[model samples]
Target chain A: MGVRVQEGDFDLAVELADFGRGAGGIVTFTGVARNNDAGNLQYMEIEHYPAMTQSAIEAIANEARSRWDLCDLLIIHRHGRLAPGARIMMVATASAHRADAFAAAEFLMDYLKSRAPFWKKEVTSDSAEWVAAKEADEKALDRW
Target chain B: MIDVVYFAWVRERIGLPRESVETDATTVAELIDELSKREERYALAFSDRGAIRAAVDQTLVDLDAPLKGAREVAFFPPMTGG
Candidate 1:
């Protein structure tokens, strides 16, 4: 159960090959890069705080474990340039019950969305812009 | 000297990703003020305080957060990570 910040894509099957030996349920979430509304996306450039990223993710992962009863967890996020349809990140949670696994996965998602030290910028054929954080994303944390 | 880093649009507007600054400021707000006075670029990047977020020594904090003993400070817009 850990966090990894990388520049390369991850293989889910290989990552879970030896995962969750005795857990009753395991849940996983994968985020994919999508094209702009005009369907002219070139690629996305992800910028991250190199010095703080891993530790920041680990802190949130630890918070998830503290809040939920889980057997294991895995969070992997990628940086750098990524093409559309490429995987951006993945989260997996294992627990003795399905509820814990599902809840933990959601919690990790909510926390990482606004709290993590990473940013995404969308580039199209003629222009590029940073993806603004939605107000709802910040408000989502209030539910916890 | 404290290492100040910028990300995303802040990096773009400031025209640099990172720099080291010798400062006597005691808080993040003061640091921003110092940087803003240096050039119009810095002023433009920091024009909207509400849209910016700061981290001192890798931990997120409010603008009033003390800069004492901090070796690094990062400024960026709200994170949009998944």
Candidate 2:
């Protein structure tokens, strides 16, 4: 298990391959930046309460582990300013079977999106706005 | 004693991000009540109690859950994490 909050990008393919180890399956989910109708988003500034963020993430990871027979997992979420098209976060899971791997990866992502402490401030061409919690995000958690 | 933290709009309403308080409460609800009585700012910050979510020692916890042995408690809006 690993949680990274940084400005650098990640290589999901390499991450998945490494996580696979001797496992039979690996599933990875990558969340990318998207252009919103609000305008051209120059960048997104992410803020998080350090201790709380880590604890929340670890709790999610623990839940994932308990639900799946996984070999390893990786969660990398970036903080600070990020331009459009940049990677926002990635979750990868490896397991002895495809079903467990797939479900676990999705579960981790869903929980991370809804439960983590990080918040985003979108910097549009005209002005900056704090991204509110989307209803869809809360709904995503119900799938688990 | 616990270190309670507020973030984003919660902090904006409460007027501070961090504070230390000693309490005899065992659950988050009691703590919230105590905090809401502190000042108008806290009252406004905790006005819509349902809109706020909490974490004990950084783990997401139900408001009615016991806070025994917790070192930190945090209140904020529903997470918008990615």
lDDT tens digits, residues A2-78, model 2? 87767788887666655768888888888887777755889887778888677678778989999999888888887
TM-score of chain B of each: 0.99, 0.96
Give TM-scores of chain A for all candidates.
Answer: 0.98, 0.91
Candidate 1: tens digits of C-alpha lDDT, residues A16-131: 98778799999999999998889999999988998999999999999999999899999999999999999999999999999999999999999899999989999998988999
Please, what are the lDDT tens digits per residue for candidate 2 over residues B1-82? 7999988788878888899999988899999999999899999989998788998887888899899999999998887777
TM-score of each: 0.98, 0.86
DockQ of each candidate's interface versus the true one?
A: 0.93, 0.71
Off by over 4 Å in 2: B22-26
10 residues in a row with least lDDT, candidate 1 chain B: B3-12
Evaluate residue A8 in candidate 1 and report its C-alpha lDDT on the 0 to 100 scale.
Answer: 95
Where does model 1 exceed 4 Å of error? none
lDDT of each: 0.95, 0.84
